[model samples]
Target: MRREQPSTQEAADDRTDALRTEATSSIVGYRLRRAQLSVFQRFLTVFESLALRPVEYTVLVLIADNPGRKQTEIAEVLGVKRANFVPLVHGLEQRGLVERVPSDFDKRANALHLTQEGEAFLAHARQVHEDMEQELVARLGGEKARKTLIELLDRLT
Candidate 1:
């Protein structure tokens, strides 16, 4: 029998399989990042039809929960910088999903609120999110494991 060289695709596959990740695999930060990526990937798939990104969804939920919260206040809680936060809020406002009105407490600051459309959209999003969360919970081995995982993650933050 004659020896034969692997094809280009086969070579690439071999290289990929041979790559090592052991150095990072056991690290807490690396594991956390990988888990985050995996979860976010599933989240993106579930929310694809809604066309909402993770941060946008978070912002919407925060505003919905705190209807009269000032933009700066929400941004601070989310740890988003003012420069980046401005464009994010503007995009939401342009989509007619959010509104910025003068803050009752601070004349110069804008209070965030969801529009009627935003509320309707959020109601749908909430249902979708709940479904996704249930799937994640099941994957994590039920509600108790999910709670424990969340508690551990919360400690890091």
Candidate 2:
């Protein structure tokens, strides 16, 4: 008697299972990248309703915390190149979530500030973020493990 052929998805799954990742898995950078991708995937799903990306949420938080900071300074802190950072800021400004004002310290610079709408949106976003953090902490085996992992990761940076 002849056996039935496996379905395409089953064949693909078999191939995937047969692949070896041990070499890359042992690398710190590879593991960190894999972790980041997993976290970001969850982040995207959680923030989908708010129409926010991880970087955008990060930028908003920075502006809220450091109101009146120079755009260049904030961008530098986040390691975002000026060219790419400009369009990100412009999009936020166009959405009326952020505003740019002339800097008092540097006539050539623009200070960044979040609008009232931004403040409101960020307040809600913060709660959502906190929830996500709690879930991650639990998955990491609780707060102590989470803290340890963060400390180890910080050392790399």
Candidate 3:
């Protein structure tokens, strides 16, 4: 007698189980990272529609709030390397969203400022982001969602 082939659904279910077993067998940290990526994937879907990277959005939001922030200070607040920010700053400059000016505190350092366009863009992008957050995480609502996510991320760090 010949053995019958497995059904498609059974094969797919077996594959999923195998993958899950493999995923769970690895280090706990790897599983944690995988879960974080899954959650943030949804977040990227929302933010990507704005046509701005999260780092770029953070820079614009920071500059809008802290007018005349020095490049060093901006890098420090965002925990990004000072040199790495040069390209992002240059891009913002090219887009007419930001301006670099002589620093009042230090002759060698340049201060950052958001141009009119940057401010307007930040405001709109932030509002859209908030709406998306609400839509995706209505269970946590506004403040609770942020607080919960922050708490969870803090524990990971």
| lDDT of every predicted structure (CA atoms) | 0.95, 0.94, 0.82
Candidate 2, 1-157: lDDT as tens digits: 9999999998887784566888999999999999999999999999999989998999999999999999999999999999999999999999889999999999899999999998998999999999999999999999999989989989988
Model 2 lDDT, residue 59, Cα: 96
Give the TM-scores of the predictions, in the order they appear: 0.87, 0.88, 0.74
lDDT per residue as tens, model 1, 2-105: 99999999988778456688998999999999999999999999999999999999999999999999998889999999999989999999999999999998
Give stretches of model 3 more than 4 Å off.
Answer: 1-18, 22-28, 139-146
Candidate 3 lDDT at 133 equals 62
Model 2 ranges with Cα > 4 A deviation: 1-17
Error of 1 at 67 (Å): 0.8
Model 1 steric clash pairs: none
What does the lDDT come to for candidate 1?
Answer: 0.95
- Name the better of 1 and 3 by lDDT: 1
